[model samples]
Target: MLTLTSPVETAFHRLPAGVKLGAVALGSVLALQVTSLAGVGLLLAGLAAAYLSQGVVFARAAGRQISGLWPVVAVILVWHGWTGAWAAGAVVSGRMIFAIGLATLATMTTRLEAMLMLAERALQPLARLGINPKAIALAMALVIRFTPVLLDKAAQLVQAWRARSPRRAGARIVLPVALAALDDAEQVAEALRARGGL
Candidate 1:
């Protein structure tokens, strides 16, 4: 699995994972409450400044991670445009972009182990209910880690499709991506079993 954490150290990397995660959660909530285009723009500007503070390399890496949002944004804009609600579309898109940016920043700065530890601690109380905190935390960590891997797989499929055909891959790659994901899951399950199964 490819880790989202950047190899280049930054000031944000020194912060506790819990704090960073909490901040992202709070920011997401606030972003959702924002309805005005101006408000969303201000928040996005602040987020951009935060990224800039981390240095060019770190900011560029974060931008690449969130680049996946473009398609979704385009869909949102198209739908809103058809409905004649351009302002609403812009606000919605901005809020989503800001929330994802905040999350990407946190993920890029924090280590997977630290996030797992934080999750485990947060879920400790659930242990009394016969729920394994370690297992739950590990599951959460794996989901975070594999999301980008799946996206990369989809990208690879698209590239392969383009290599042979002039047309876009579009939905044609869905089945292949699903099968690939299943294969990955099976391998991961086997690896977990070998390591004393979560």
Candidate 2:
């Protein structure tokens, strides 16, 4: 998962999830206008301050989550560098960092159930068009809830492979991970049926 809500008693955790989510959407829109390191740096600086207000550990967790896309970021930077478009690469990477960073912040601060309730309320207008917003809300909540679990499982599999093999895990753990995911899905399906289906 990109973010898991911290149990820390931060002020942001007390705010309405809808407000934070709206702000994140607006922030993402503004992030797109950033075309220079200075603009991105300003945003990052502000975010850093906010995170730091929560605590050093909260800030560190956020940083780790942000770094997960380093491989993709590296490719963009290297490709642009090779083509002599270093500035463009920086802008793109910076935009990505800002956009994802804000979204992750909102995620980390808001409880998953609160987010689901807010999303369901926000989607109510779609009900007029015959859409089942509750179902959508449930799906979104499930994704938010399980994404971190899935990532952890993947990491554990990789670690297990590393412990048993001299070489890197790489693609070797894919099959096992797939099977684990399938098992999770089956369990979810069974539980949902027992609950009378969603």
Candidate 3:
């Protein structure tokens, strides 16, 4: 599985995964309360400063991870523009950028093992309800790890489509991507079963 954790050591790398996760969750919730463009801008500025404090290389890596948000932001902007709600669109986009930035930062700084451990710990109480915390944690980690992989696969499909056709791939690639994801899942399941099944 591909890990998002950065190799460059930073202050956030020393912080507990749970702490970073909790902070991101809280910040995301608070970000939703911010409806004003000025407030969202200030929040984004603070987020950018945090990234900069991590040094140029780390900041660039973080920026690249969040760059995928541009497509979603464009969709949001287009819808809001059609409705003639420019300010609302700006505020919504800013808030989303801030939230995703914070999440990307946390993921880049925290190790997968550390996050899995934290999730297992947090879900310990659920074990009493016939739930398997380790399995749950593993599932969460797998989702996090595979999300980028899936995105990369989709991008590759798009590129391949463009190479063969003048038109966009559009929904044509959806089935192939879904098939690829299912194939990956089957392999993972087999591996887990070989290791005594989570």
Give every collision pair in model 2: none
lDDT of each: 0.91, 0.85, 0.92
Q: Write one digit per residue (lDDT tens) for candidate 3, span 101-191.
A: 9998898988888888988998999999999999999899889878989999999999999999999899999999999999999999999
- Using Cα atoms with residue i matched to residue i, what is each candidate's TM-score against the true structure? 0.85, 0.85, 0.88
Total clashes for model 3: 0
2 or 3, which is superior by lDDT?
3
Best by TM-score: 3
Q: Which pairs, if any, clash in model 3? A: none
Residues 70-137 of candidate 2: C-alpha lDDT, one tens digit per residue: 99899999999999999999889888887888888888888878888888998999999999999899
In model 1, the Cα lDDT at residue 149 comes to 91
Error of 1 at 185 (Å): 2.9
Candidate 2 segments whose C-alpha is farther than 4 A from its true place? 1-3, 160-169
lDDT score, candidate 1, position 187: 98
Candidate 3 local Cα displacement, residue 31, angstroms? 1.7
